[model samples]
Each structure stands twice: as structure tokens, then as C-alpha cells.
Target: MQRKLSKATTLLFAVTAGQASAALFEVDPGPYDPAIGSFAAWYQDTHGRTLDLCLSKNVSSRVAGAPGAPSYMCSLLPEPGVFDDAEPLVFPTNFPPEAFWFTADAAIADAASGIDLTFGAAIEAAFAVEEPAEGDQISFARIRIRVDVPTIGTYTVTHPYGVEVFDVTAAEFGADGGRAINMTRDIGIGAPKTYNGALGGDIGPFLRSVNGPYAEVNPATGQLDRFIGDPNLDEPVTGSPFDTNYVRIQGPGGIDLRTNLFAISGKLSEVVRPTPVIVQRATYSRSSGEAGLSTQQDVFAMAPPPPATAQYLDSAAATVPMTEANATGNWYGQSSANATPPATVEVSADNSVAIPNSTPTTLSAPLVDVVSIQRAEYSLNSGQLTLVASSSDETEPPALTATASSGAAIGTLGGDGATKTLVTGISPTPPAKVTVTSASGGSDTEEVVLLP
Candidate 1:
């Protein structure tokens, strides 16, 4: 017997035909505002730290209320207390250090009039798993553009990806006589509202023209409406594709005048465990007696918990445990002889079977040598012992510990391929022989030469 489908299913298929074809692309916004172009863009972290992403020519001149400057001037100046000026927004702070970040740039300019009339902007954002939910972490990017054109003229935007033309007419200066365009382009999983289920087929990461006053044929009413796009429907809307350039403005300036363009990335899914980061790796030989025995130490920079909730190290020799280092705020693991290369390191936020885990990383064998102790000397008057060491790898020096012949610990010191001086108390006195050991188990013992 043949079965007839419901009208809702049929309508869903019809709406799916109008799915958006554009996808978000990644671009480097460069250093916040440089002194070359009329553009300014920034990335604000959850902690309220702002980072400039483009070059700005006349940032000071485009201040609000400034003569000839647009009312919503793009200011490169960071907000006091709200913006972090000392350091840029780093990874793992706002975004998962392991997740991929995508960015895009769009600008229009007409410098033929002697003065630089540029409307350039960029976006740097990312989307990742928030755990317990898929694709829920949407780190939306703020798309800020500097509009410095005091006179009405046509401005054409061209970039490596696409180009668009905008005619700066009087109408663009809204009722308030100000030029401003802000809109958000988000669809699929983390959208504010659900569109036609399955029918819309993820038509997002693109500017939505329907949110603004742009004119488009309304699918519901079949008549031209200012709010033409329906976030609820998969119908065609007059907006810029999310990945290429900003949506084509249907109004006076062809700019979306509703909301700021905050691009969304990543797909809807449970948060995946963040990949383990191996910051440094080194191999060290055991003391002279233990020939052919070497130990490999791997220092890893652990990602913050939501994604890297738990971390572990697996190898042939033994499953090593990892712990966070208080000194460097990183995770450390070590394996000695008999352990095979290409060890697997994994992390997970959820130990249960419900959530997706982080991708396991294959750690290769260490190719560089760990630092080794070289010399030892004692100062009789000061009761001070000096230990010297050298490292083949200067970038990641091994930590060292010094001990006396009586097995009493003298002192611990960090290695920088330099001499380490430790003061021995009069009670312990100075031992005739001193032994230095590296974090990787490399050791060197030398007779202490007494000094005046």
C-alpha cells in the first residue's frame, strides 16, 4: 500500500531547496589598528580583553562627534578597564586552545578624492564544543568598520575572496543622520531561534537581510516586505554569504542596518576533548653505570577544563600519570627505557560514553638531549656550593636538583645553561662530593673543590 506524506513534510522539502550555499572562511585580521588604512576591528574575550585586528589610518579623527566622522565611528582606542591593553587576547582564555579559529575580512574604499574614504573591517571568531552540548560554544566576533567618508560617493570593496559596491546616499544616514550597520549572521545549531526544521538545512554563517529594512520578496505573504528574510524559513533572504564577504545591503548603503555581524562557526555536537599540547620533549642518558638506558620527558601545556577535563598518557613501557606543574602551569609526563615511540596522549571532559572525547595525540620520540650537570665546587668561608650545568637545547632547559654525599638535599635550582649557587648551612656542612640530578634522571657527581 502506498502512503501519502503530510503537508508539513512536503513544505519542508520545498524550503530546503533555498538553502544557503555560502560557508564561513578564515582570514588573518593582522595587527589591530595600524597607521595605514581606514579600518579597525577587534576581538573581545569573555574576560573583556579586546585585541585590535587591523590597521587604522585616522582612528583619532573618527571619534564620535568628531567633524566629518560618522556618528558610529570605529574607534581603535581600547575601553578603559574593559579592554586589556597590555597583552593580546590569547588562546585557551576565550577560546579552546585546541579548537580551530576562523576569520574573514571585508572592506570598501574610494581614495581617489585625495582623502582616504575607506570602509574596511574584519572578523575573528571561533565555535567549539561547550561540553554537555554540541556546537554550543559560539565565540561570536565583532565586525567593526571605520566609516570616514564625509561626502557622498560610491565605495567599492575588494578583497582576495570577493568584492561588493555600495552607493553612499543620503538615505544611508538613517533618521538620526548617522551611518551604522550592525547585524548578526548565525544559523543551524546555536541560532537564537529555530528556523524551519530540516527544511532550512543550516542556512546561516551568512548575514540575514530580513532582520533589517532591506526589501525582499516575502515567502509567507508573497509580497515585498522590509523584513523579508525569515529565520524560521529556509527561503532566500537578501544578506551576504557568511564565508565570503558581508551580505549585500539592500538599502541606501547596501549594508545590513539591523544587528552587528557576529559570525558563528563549528557544528552542533557534544564538546570534544581538547588535543594534548606537547610543548617540549627531551631525552637524557642515565648515569655512566646505566649504559643504553635513557629517559624521555614530555612537557605538555594543558588546555583549560571544559574540553580537557581529564588528561592521561599511554605508552608501551607503562601508562604514565600526568599532573599540572605549579611553576609553569603545564602538564608533565615522563617515560624511561623500554617505552616505545609514538605514545598516545588523550583527554576527556566526560568519562562516560555519552559525550565525544578529545582526539588522541601521538607523541614521538624525543630527539634533543636534556641538560646535564658539569661541575661542582664549594666555598668554605661562605658555606656555599656552586653547581654548573649545560644543555644542548637552550629553549627548554631541564630543571636540576643538588644533593650532598650524605643523601641530604642541598637545594633545587632551575637550569639555564648557567652556574647555580646554593648556600649550605653550617650544621649540614659541605660534603666532599656533590651530585646533581636533572628532572629527566640525568645525573652527574663531582668532588667538591674547597675554596678560601
Candidate 2:
């Protein structure tokens, strides 16, 4: 018996881009410390302030002296140092380190000093991808905005996604003489969560009506008497579910921090290369009667640059077979073309088992396939023709190539999915027709029809 499976394309509209290089600081994941508990991961800003994400229950002694420490948390200025003799907080178990990841950028100074003193920072994390036995593959992520402010003032932190303004007060400051205001969201693979997946706890720079000494600014009227403190003020914030850019601060505050966590299931087949590719794991079961069957598995990947050919590798590189029933095995394959989505890569696995004194049985199914070019537009003006192709993958748009009817290459665009535009200057008006091809081997061609 033989079988084959293909994944349906999922349309996701969003922009995905790379980050700028800067100084990065990382703490060595040494032996787990009881005092600090365990440092699962960390993100450090340009100013040297470190935010540690803990896996264990105890708070780091470095920040133990600070009042009202948080447990099972990632916050500012926490590091791995001397052990705190404090009792450890009871934390949930069975958490996997691979399920959580973090990365951040340096702080951008919005104000040098005074009431308008502020520094903007960005932090990001990658959570585990939830791939069910049936249904669509869902990726999960967390985005956090942490602001540290000294002195009472109104400030705003702006990133590629959205903008947030806060009126700080002395009472809001932490023991470090600074207030850490946080806004967080847990987003899934589909549309932006917006108001969904909001995790709010005790720690807060909660929504409070702005009063004297701090008046909110109104954009429409330029009124300084505008009252702030609406928790839902920045509703439906826009941001890619996978990545983030540097944050900028404005007004009278310092240390604005933004953090985002994304879910990664596999590595890109082109462009940037990530080490130790992330793979899928599952349990395989067989009845006792088929215990003596010999099995073989083969894995292959296909990605954009149309007419994408299948790239196959040894099953050992992609899978660790289940030696026994109900046991788990790891399976790796290429699932992404870049950091963000509109997943352009497709992965398939073929498993064959030889039955004792019988013909072998084979099963094939796509492991990954979730993005494609959903739409394309062409326009001509002043002898210049432009082609814009939109993809369903929001994270990382697959590379696209445009060709003229004369078989001449027009241009190719990729990287950011938000902006996949190709422009070319032609002599005799528009070409008779144009074809756009995606890296995933999908193509769309349309005849040029000019207005009379």
C-alpha cells in the first residue's frame, strides 16, 4: 500500500524582517542554582540591564533585596549570582527549555534626561509550536512591554507594531526607584490576538485616571488636559506574531522595554541558517502481531523559487524511530524559509514497514505546508510597470520572481512579506502578460489589460 499527503496553504498577511546588529550579552547556563533557581534564558539591553527568565521557583539573590519579587517570571535586572536563602516558590513542572526562547535588542534613547528622559528597548521570545494530529499547525508566542521610569511623567513607547503611553507616579515605582509597567499578549498562529490571550496579574502600572501634574496628550485637539488610563487604549496593536523591531521612547521616562516570544517549528531552507534545526516529535505504535516488522522512513523538503524540487536526506537525519509502541521519536525537517511566517516550505515523510511474509505497507503525509502567494497585482504608469504579490504567510514571505511575456526577467522580491513589490521600466507600454512565481513552486500569470 502507498499513500501521499499535501498541506493546504494558509493565508496570513503580515510583515517579517531581520534585526539590526548590536552588542549581545548572555549568561552561561551553568549548573542550576537553588537561590536563583534555574535561569532558563535571558535578554540583555544595550544599557547592560538584564532580564532573566527563570525555570525554577527561587528568585535570584541579586534582586532578592528588591521588594515583592516575582516567581516564574522574566523581569528587569535579575541575574545569576549568590544564592538567596529564601524559600523557593512552588512552580509547575514538566516545562521544557526548548519550548521557550528569548532575544532582545539595545535600548533606544528617546530623551537624554529630565521629565522626558526615556529609553526604548525590545525583547522577544519563541514558544513551542502546537501541531495536532488533525487540524492546522498552530504557533504560539508572547509579547511583553516593560517600562522603567524615574520621576512622575507621561511617556510613550513606540515600536513597529503599535504605540503605548503611560503616566508614571511615585507609587508605581519598584524598590529600585523605578516603575516597571508591563503589557503582554499571547498570540496564536492565525490573525493577531488583539484583545485575546492577555495575561494580567497582580504586578501592574494599572489603568488609573490621569489627574493633575500629569495630563494625557490628545492627538486630535492637542489638548494637555486629556485624561489617560484606559487599559484598552491600545487595542488591536499590530505586530507580527513571530518577530519584533527596536522600540523607541518619547516623553519623560527612561528604560522602555518591549519583549516578544514566537513559536518556531523548523529551520529555513534558504537565506539565514539556524543551528540545531528544531524538529517535530511523536509516538508511533504498532500492534503486537506486527512487532517483528522492519521499518524505514524517508523525509524530504520543498521550498520556494518556483518549481521547487524535493530535497531528500537520510531518515536518520530527520527521525529517531520509535523502538517500541507508545514511545516517542524526534523528526526534523525544513518548514520555514525565514524567521517570520507565510511558511513557504513543505515537508513530507514516507514510512514503510515490511510485514513478515507479506508486501510492505507505506504511508506518506506532509509534515509542513502552510503558506502561498494568495494574490498579485500589476499596475503601469509612465512606462513603468509595478507588480505587487501578496502571500498568505505573514511571518516570512517567500521569494518571488516576476517575468515579462517576452521571457525577460523583471525582478525578484523577498525578505519582508509586508512589502513584496517589483517594479520595472518598459519601453512599449505594459507587457502582453506577466507571471509571478513563488519560491514554493507556485505561479500566477495575468494578461495586461490597460484602461482605454
Candidate 3:
């Protein structure tokens, strides 16, 4: 199924002026490049991390062809980290569990076997941990060079993932029909060469020690030899040039493929979130029962100021627990029973309070007349206060309205005309005031203090 696509192979990226005809090709050069995306700027933007390898050596070689044919050259640079063993290769553990290692291998297969080797530097070989084929791991890590042909805008070399080359035999190379691979080319300095399958010309085998017995060669003849029941060293080939191996391409006219430039990045940990604040029912209970028929009773409740200190206006008038009293006509009034439950009281705990951090403060008592302030609620968000003015005798309850001091605004009155709401922007520092007025012209003023 693996066939070297023709140079006319369409590029994955659109062809720009003086750019390579193809964008990505396949090749199995060796272990997954530890420094993946080292030269890819786009890689950094997408993966959020950079490759681990560093560039060691970069050199340019010019190939002169027959007069007027075409002048071209490419750079011979090793893949990042190929040369420096001091820095061990480390794969990212952050990758998805199912992520597999991918690489590109270089080779020229049987030219006469209907397989094409014309795609100058496209991917030729690869191995994946999850690859279905159970092939030898030895041939998986082969070192190939980079071939950057500037003129035609093509760099024939290995990339991470792509289609695999067709399988064939070493017999094609005059050896036993062993494992087949797509051979990578070299950036020759002393001597120059062109690509011809094992049939007639030099079919470049990976020069670096990483690839052993895989299209292995006779160093003496530089010709590819077959696997003679011998396996490559358990480890990659060692030493200097080995350390600097890079991805390379072999164009027919001797053009070089330049490695593209790019970067890598990653996150350390997750962010922590904050907790929410909750307002609970007011802390209060009925203290005394209303006197039978027409007498008032003392209302008592603990105002549990929030730890953060708060300014609140509380009243027990409209909220006093009420009961039906027996008479010529049953009348609704404050409960005679002392154990009646009280309604919730709201408190506004504005942060701008004048009291010292450790000081505990309480609001002033309301102006008491015929009607008494029964229950009060304060809204923390709006700094609004609602007070209930109540009378012991429901039939004669006073009609009440509220007035505010400086920086305060009055809201609606209750249906019974005994409850009033006041809004204020005054800081708790100076304390705000509200006066409750009865329809009969009687009035009482109360001081609102915010606690710390």
C-alpha cells in the first residue's frame, strides 16, 4: 500500500510562491523526536508546549549540475537533541493515555515493483506502539538527514504522523528478502549522489547509529545490505556524528531541504476557586406576650451581627406574633402567648464601618409611643431597612410612615400603613437616622449603627 508519491503530489498546504509542492510527507528516521515541534512555530500555538531537543549543527552544501540545468542546495542539520546525549530524551506524560510514538524512516524500495520512489522527500516508514503489525522494534529507530531544496520549495524528510510505505524485501537490494523500508538521503559534503532504488544506484541507508540492521549497510561499500539473521544493537549506535543526526532529503538534481522554524509550551496545574457567602434566618425569639385586649409588651431578640460588622435597623411592630382575641367580635392583635415565633430580621453588613475591628456595636432603640417598633429587616446588598410598627390593639393600630436623615431615601409603606422602608448611602461610620411618624402627628427617631 506504501508507494513514494510523485513530486507532483499535492501539498497539504496551499502552494505559495517558491514553496514546496507538498507540505507533509512520511518517513521513519528513529525514535519519536524527543524534541517534537522544535522548529515548528505553528506547533507551539496548537500543542501549548515546545519540543525538548536543541539544534547542534547546521551547514549548507551546494550541488552544481550540468550547465544551465538548475542550481540548488540544502542544509544538513541534525534533528534537535540528536547530538547531545547529556540531555536525556523525555516524552511528555501529559499526553493522552492512548497517544502513540510516531517517526519517519527513509529508504528507496523495489523500483520495478510498481511502487514509486519519485516523491523526493515524503514520509516512507513509521512505527506506532499501537500499530497493528507486529514488526521488529530494531528497524523502527533509524537516523535520517534533512534535505532542504530551496529552489523547488520542498524539504524531503520525516514528520510525526502520516501513511506508511508499502512492505517489501531486502532481496530487492541483492540480499535476502528481509524487511522493507523507505531510505532517507544524506547531505553529502565530500561526494554528491542521486536517488536510484537498490536495483542500479545508491539507495541511502540511515548513516546514524540509531537505525541498525534496518536497511543496514556495509560501511566498506556504502551499499544497503539485507538483514542476515542479525539484529541491531539493543541500543542506538553511539558516538559524535551519531549525536548530530538530522532529517535529510535526496532530490534527483541534488537540492537540499531546509528545516522549518517553530516553538513549544505547557501548563503546570489547575486554578482554585473561592467559597460563597450565605445569609441565614435572623437570630431572634419572642420575649414577652401582649397584655390582654389593649396593652403592649416588651419584645426581645438577639441581633447576631455578622462577624464582619453590620449596620441594621430592627423593629418588632408589624412582625409581632398575632392571635385572635375573644370579644363581642373576635379581634386580631399581638399574641397573648409569649412563645410565638418571630419573623426573620434582615441586617446590612456594609464593609465601610467606623468601629474599630474588635469593637462590638448595636443600633439605638426605636422611638416608642402608642405603637412600638416590632421587627426590622436590613438588606446587605441595597443598604435598605424595613421596620414594622405595631399596636397591641389591632383595631386601633396607628397609621405610620417613615422619614430619613441625610443621605437616606424612603420607600413604600405596608398595607396596614405601619411598616416603612428606608434606603441609605451614608457610610456606617457616622450612623444614619430614621423617624417613624404616626398619622396622629406623633413621631419617634431611631439611630442606625453598623457594628464591627
RMSD of each: 24.8, 22.5, 31.8
Question: Model 2: per-residue lDDT, tens digit, 53-114?
Answer: 32223222222333544422122222223223133332112222122222222233233342
What ranking of all candidate models by TM-score puts the best one first? 2, 1, 3
Would you list the C-alpha lDDT of every candidate in the order shown? 0.35, 0.32, 0.27
- lDDT (C-alpha) at residue 300 in model 2: 28
Clash count per candidate: 18, 24, 63
lDDT of 3 by residue, 10-32 (tens): 22211111211111111222334
Q: Per-residue lDDT for 20-138 in model 1, tens only?
A: 22222111133322222112232221111122322111121212344543221112233344333233433323222112122222333334322222222223222334321222323
Question: What TM-score, to 2 decimals, does candidate 1 have?
Answer: 0.23
TM-score of each: 0.23, 0.24, 0.17
lDDT of 2 at 420: 78
> Using alpha carbons, what is the TM-score of model 3?
0.17
Per-residue error for 239 in candidate 2, Å, reads 18
- Native RMSD of candidate 2 (Å): 22.5
